[model samples]
Target: MIAIDNKLISDEVLDEQFVCDLTKCKGGCCEDGDAGAPLEDWEMKEINDHYEAIKPYMTPEGIREIERQGKYIYDKEFGWVTPTINGAICAYGFRDEKGIIKCAAEQAYNDGKLDWKKPVSCHLFPIKIQKSRRDPDMEYVNYEPREDLCKAACSLGEKLKVPVYIFLKEALIRKYGEDFYEALEAVAGYKKNND
Candidate 1:
């Protein structure tokens, strides 16, 4: 696990071309079973609203099953969390008749009907948010990306136009500090321009 400071990242990294090839990964992040990154009050509202709007599209049995599992409970000791709905498969994920796994929120995004603010948790994955006592600020931490998780992030990065380095930096800074970020920047530069 790596901690990253959100302030250390420059806008250049945010706009770079870091692509994730998801077709090769098959939604590993969705399968890792952890969702609901720590939410601020506003973020919670957004998630609740999105859940209400998307509730109709979900299978009733699926919703019941998730409820039965107590997936909605927020535990202070464990932090804001939820069990993966549908046996660790995302509720929004499904197979088409041809057997291609699809993400409903992504499809909605493509159709231009989805609220970008909704599902705030979906955007923050693998990278968990933690509060910093040193700076008294919130920080993002990378909790060991599974091989498949990296692939899924690669895919989402392509769709969202975010670089993996940005994610990495954010995670690193939250867990470490400016010096760590500088070290990572040097390493990243070496990798980018190496012979």
Candidate 2:
């Protein structure tokens, strides 16, 4: 593990390669999860504040689900999370003509209707965060490749020689900060040379 700022990062983040193959995966991660996308308190507030703007981009069912669930819901295992439609696909998801699920929140963001680009948790795909049981302030940030859904991404990453950290640079920087990402890059370089 690599210690950076307040988080402990797994080596797979540096060693493993990954690049989302959206065409192949069809955004199945948004639909296949047992639970909804994890949410922070602030994210819940953001959704509530911007629901009207985001609503135009979502499915009627998704909007109804979100309204019925009231922004976010708590799961016994996953804490606070976005609501889902029929206990599947995220309430903020819509299917494209290609039969792939896409994020409505992101569509709104891209359209300049909102500043928030989807939730940080969703932005930082394949890198789930866990708060330390031993130290409340510490977090474990690791690469969690969902093999079934991410096989193409893994293959592409390896073919392109792009490490997971590099592929996820924008999201990581969004969740952490530019300095944290710079630190991560430095560490990745060191690890590459030392190994």
Candidate 3:
């Protein structure tokens, strides 16, 4: 399971030998299918707006592709209420000159033409933030330091250089609040067994 929290973990632990070897596996995360995570109302709105803005650049087939997958519903209390699509890959997924899969969103962002309202989930790859089903108010676990398994399981893992925990904390705090940062910190520390 993916870990989500606001507490900061020591970078030292992050650098520990326990970190899984990622090179052995392909990026299963990018290619296997759509891995659903929650989204806020604002998040949904952003994604919709982006889709509209980029609609001209997108072919009808592209639009239909995403539409066929359906949109994710959001709930105030529950956060992202549903993942209506299956095998949902990001709009930006493509191969590079080196034959590695790269995110189009990142490329667009770098190109300075990306719609800021795109779903945060679209940009936040590998890293995921989920509210605890057992305790919605409480953030979930911090780090899922299973790079080896993740790389093996996720087809896009090879290109996913950033640590999942790092991305999750940064994305959550940016989208949510400082509370999320604190939660991530705690979880990071815990993952290190730092107490």
Give the better candidate number (2 or 3) by lDDT.
Answer: 2
- The per-prediction tally of clashing pairs is 12, 0, 30
lDDT of 1 by residue, 9-116 (tens): 333343343444456556555555545233456545644556655554555554675567543446565355444564465655555555444555455555665554
Residue 7 lDDT in candidate 2: 96
Off by over 4 Å in 3: 1-28, 33-38, 53-62, 71-88, 115-127, 145-169, 176-195
TM-score of 3: 0.52
The full ranking of all candidates by TM-score, starting with the best, is: 2, 1, 3
lDDT: worst 10-residue window of model 1: 1-10
Which segments of model 2 are wrong by more than 4 Å? none
**By TM-score, who's the top model here?**
2
Predictions in order: lDDT: 0.51, 0.91, 0.46
The prediction achieving the highest lDDT against the true structure is 2
For model 2, state the Cα shift of residue 37 in Å.
0.6
